[model samples]
Target chain A: MDLAPLALSLQVAVLATLVAAIAGVGLATLLATARFPGRDLVDVLATAPMVLPPTVLGYYLLVALGRHAALGRAFEAVFGTPIVFTRVGAVVAASVGALPLVVKSSRAALEGVDATLVQAARTLGAAPARAFVTVQLPLAARGIVASLMLAFARSLGDFGITLMVAGDIPGETQTASLALYDAIQEHREAAALEMALTLTAVAIAILYGVGKLTARSARGA
Target chain B: MAPDGDRPSLHVRARVVASHAFALDVAFDAPPGVTVLFGPSGSGKSTTLAAIAGLTRPAAGRIALGDEAWFDADARIDVAVHRRGVAYVFQSLALFPHMTAAENVAYGVSRALTPEARGERVRALLGRLRVAHLSTRRPATLSGGEAQRVALARALATEPRVVLLDEPLNALDRSLRRELAGELREALGQLGVPVVFVTHQSEEARALGERLVVLEAGRVTHVGTVRDVDDAP
Candidate 1:
């Protein structure tokens, strides 16, 4: 019942959330606004993770980032370390699992923002980047915050993907979920129950935050 | 020579197929005074303004202020919306919900040399629009008239070559619209820049317009001085 796994889990979840939020929000904005050819295809690709099995996602990551893969070789050669079976790998897996939640929710939020506000910003001499930062992003913030929190929760509870790619390395890749699984197997019922309760508390907090955001956005509309 | 020999004129000849339901073919010349785009709903008044502002692309023809072409379909010149230096006051106000009225006004003055300069510009515009008291308030807290003033202040802070307003006071009550209309007209007159104000109300058009361009089903049905249009056979 070491505390190391708990700390690692928190770190992985936080990093995963950060990564997912930045990339997911950018993708969401593109999906919400841009109108190039094959935009629908790009949108589907971004959101496919929501429906894809976590194990399948992990399997694809493993194929592309495995020690024998060219990308894995280049990464190891540059960094002097392998990405597979590392805590970073757990973060990668968790982020992929959580990304679709951020993308979908933030896209919906960005779309809900009145186009007139963005148009006003443009007409008032603000560039596209400036307009988005000043107007659209601020207006869509509630939904973005809701989506990020949901991503964090998803990353925290991720099991199948983390297990497949990062494995169950003690004090490194052994996140709280992995530790809980181990505790149950080793007959440490108390440790298993503690980890389960902790995860449930985190989930409830995130759900409450998301609920408030949804209500606020509803009121705004 | 034409009157106002050196002053730039906004000359627009745009034919835009905006959507399946709307197509706009309009041509007009506006000097540095309020030229009202008078029309009922769905008559492409807003679309015409949007085209001039570079928010909408024309299917053909050109738009120029003096010699500088804002858009020319044949020449392949289309200015970016923000680079066009045109400000718009939307019918919906479109005030930034997250910012105070002061901040919203400040956003239009990106070329201000310093923070103090930006603050001064915002103050001057808010004062001119008589919404200085609402500077610290968010748009949601402001009354419709106050919000309209803030929107006007935001538009003017850009120091734009032209200001386009889409039914700027339509959201207010009848009394408020009437009160603000007079103030808005005075304020716009003092700026000495071309103002394309859109309105469906004939009275509002007559009250605020020096020149009137009447649209019907996306076509310019009439273009003349307000008095001339009113007296037309």
Candidate 2:
């Protein structure tokens, strides 16, 4: 009857999805629109997480958010909160794991928008910010939803990053995936199977919802 | 000499480099009337319109509207599109799909007005263009004529020093084209500003333009009234 792991999993997933979506949309904006020196380099770096194994990302996050790391120590000194082995740390790991999906989908959505629509806004006396908010963003709203769904689903299944960085402290940092893994190792076959089935069902439902939105029904709406 | 009066005039000299492997060297004067630029497809008529509207930068030249320079490469000053004292209605109409007809019209005047004034101005524009009742309709719902008029009203809403229309009548069928062409002519004529409009059809050029510039290839072949064009090939 230990529900702490399940609660921690949900909390980490929600927080990670939020952080990844924000960063991904911002990154997508740059990828789809901005022209700068070394733009390709930034694109590669942002997408690096996608190609990396979750374990690799976890290892990096472990070092980056750990006590001795510059960022971790700076946080402890300035904000009185250390990320490692904490719920927030689990969130940070999950966001890193799911970032690629958000970035890729958001960029595609932005690129699919009509540039002429942007020009039309300009002639209508809209500044760049106004044009983006009123025209570009709405036209690409479908793509945005796709990004969110991908990030949310991926974050929900994040295990390696959480395991490596947050260290499976049941009530404090152990997410659903880590708990399932732990249950399997401890020979709790029924519990592990149930958790696995629940995660799979959630993932499938989210994917089905995204498919429905992309169908003609959402366009007419 | 021409009549001495206060009327808007735009003198534009521009050399356009083709996106492909050619250059469209064009220059013309639009002196406070509907000066039609007529040419076959790819003859650089649109290039000239784009240059005047500040959409395309000329390789080396100058553009001035009523004694004010819009682009002077020699002086290294090229005004950006929104601040060029000109309004351009592109061939595609390029309406914002998400906005209603009234909102599209209101968008231009919105930046310069209080909310109440913006609403009134949009309504007046829609009424003048005879699309007042269709204000709530999205662009996808509007007919070709309605959309064109909405674009025209939006362009003219700001009272630009010059109005540039490129193939404004090409999108419609013959009957609608002729009907809206009249409305288009009235809109341009009523404006006390320079209008350099472009078209490919000889008939449309003759009907709507007070002055015509016929382009052959990438050069100006003739500049005169309809009779001059009729007497040519």
Candidate 3:
């Protein structure tokens, strides 16, 4: 069986996880610590992707990052290529789909850190950002790592948004899930089963790792 | 100018409505010595400390260290907590659990110090607090008294202009509390900065206080020397 789809999926998932993790942690920290006028609205928007239908999210992404949009135009200007129907589009879709998991989990982890410890740090001459980096972030590292694994799993299996944004171009944008779907539609049972089992195994491994991290953190706490 | 000459006094006059039922309206002065904020639970002793430290904003009041105003609601001037040059040992002794005792102490030490100087300062503070031997250990492994000393060491690491201790020894047993109280007094006596020590225990207050500010139901009941307050009719 051709492994192009698996290779492409891994590449996209890795990039998507990196992008999602950075944005997710930042959003999570802001939500956990700061109070602003539109705080709740920002939180709702951050979490909308998780609960919204994939098609809805896909349509939104298309509108927001399509050729006519500012972000899309900027990207095309820089890279000389449109974002939609490309591997870059796959990464963006997966990152959006996986962002909520990272944000929710990371926010919980950050908030779990003792508020008094942060106060003590502040009183001990640490600025707010310094206190977060030295105390809160270290305390919450385990949960954040687990969140990253969950994000990776989500990114790897992204289908509907990826399909809508990236489109299925065989050997290019056709990721593992898309390949599995294509195989079954063509009555290729062996190829379909192989892809299904592989994805399942990888997901299970990631979930198991996440569980261990969570258990370790619980015990440490 | 403060009567104490070069050493500044902490002057706090503030009103905080913690909730519909609990409002703290207090005013007091802490000169360059231990000034015990004596009150029962829920009397707002800790809240008063927080307000001075700039962690809690008072609705309308002013907090000043000598000539410099740390917080002034009317003037709209509130120094951020870190820039206030105030060190605080919380009631829970909020040591950084992820750091070793030495690292925790070093954390507040001036970054202007070279790494070696910082290490030396941490060592000296821990040694002075009698927690030097436990420097390699984390807070979780330390006993209550040991953790208390480590917390005190961390607070003093910065050589703050003011120090706030919120019942730092309250978690210890009576005997340990007595033993550590003496050490705390000796350590604080040498600082020459205004020290605000909070406690609900009358004994602890008397043991450490040079001046006493008593609170009852979020209002200042009395402010006098320990002797004056105790000797009152």
Candidate 4:
């Protein structure tokens, strides 16, 4: 069978993981540290995608990034291409699907850091930014890494949202999961079986890496 | 002006209203010597140190180091923790776990001193604290007393105007505590900065405190020289 679907899936998931790692870790730090009115509400909203149905998330994304929508128009103005049915669309869908995993796990990691340690750094003449980079971030790094691995695995398996936004365009938008579905519909059982095994192996390897990272963090703590 | 020419004093007047259990309503002045905040646990001794170090904001107070105003609630001037130029040796000995003893001490030294000065200061302070052998070791590898000395070296590396010791020796065994207490006293004497030493142990207070300020339930019960407190009821 063609390997283009597998390549496309890898590209989408890698880009999505990068996006989630930066934005998700930042959001997690904010949730773990800052306190203000309705902070709990914002936290719930950030993690809602995890429990919400993938189709519902896809529908919302479609509405928000539709060709005529405000945000979609702005993106088109800059890129001269609509987000819908594009490779970028798949990346966005996978990133959203993976975000909750990163945020929830990384938030726990950040909170596990001792408040007294942070205070000690401050009183030792370290500014807030310096303390975070030198102490808090390093202390929480293992947990963040484990969570990112889980997010990458989750993004690779994303089907519903990716299908909704990127659609089936072979060698472009059709990711491995979408290709597997197409192979099954066309009665190509061998191709479907190969894709399924490949996906399963990739998922298992990622999950095994995540397990090792978490074990290391627990021992360090 | 101080009697010793331009030698500036540290003045702290704070009224921090927390719950009855943790509230702090106290004030005292410290010259260039060890002034112990002697009290039992939960008597707001640590709170007072935190307020002076800018880790805790007081409800109404003024904290000044010489002529520099660190915090003044009425005047609405509160310096950030780093800018206050106050160093602390936390009771927990909050050493950076990722860095070696030398790196931890070097952190503060590198911030304020030139590169050459930082190297010299780190070497001298670590040698003084007797942690020169453990310079490359992480905090987890060090013993409790070793960790405490590393914390002290890190604090002193900044050459702070004030040093706050929040029960730094509490975690050690009795003999180790006594030995380190003597070393700490010597170190403080050489540094020439006003030290706010917090301790619940009466022996430590007597051993290190030139002046004693007693606290009970968030209020200053007595403030005097060590002899004055010992002579009182």
For candidate 4, the per-residue lDDT at B112 reads: 49
Q: TM-score winner between 1 and 3, please give it.
A: 3
DockQ by candidate, in order:
0.86, 0.53, 0.87, 0.81
Q: Which ten residues in a row have the lowest lDDT in candidate 4 chain B?
A: B1-10
Model 3, residue A147: C-alpha shift (Å):
1.1
TM-score of 2: 0.92
| Local accuracy by lDDT, each model | 0.89, 0.82, 0.93, 0.89
DockQ, candidate 2, vs. native dimer: 0.53
- Candidate 4 on B104-194: residue-level lDDT in tens? 9998885546788887888898998888999999999999999999999999888888999999999999999999889889889887778
Q: Is candidate 1 or candidate 3 better by DockQ?
A: 3
For candidate 3, the docking band is high
Best by lDDT: 3
Model 1 stretches astray by more than 4 angstroms: B228-233
**How well does each candidate superpose onto the true structure, as a TM-score?**
0.94, 0.92, 0.96, 0.94
lDDT of 3 by residue, B1-233 (tens): 57677888889999998899999999988999999888778999999999999999999899999989999999999999999999999989999988999999999999999999999999999999988999899888999999999999999999999999998887899999999998999999999999999988777877888998889899998888776555422
Whole-model lDDT, model 1: 0.89
RMSD (Å) per prediction: 2.1, 2.4, 1.7, 2.1
Model 4 B-chain TM: 0.94
Model 1 / residue A21 / CA error / Å: 2.0
**Candidate 4 residue runs with Cα over 4 Å from true position:** A36-38, B1-5, B110-112, B227-233
> What docking grade applies to model 4?
high
Clashes of 1: 0
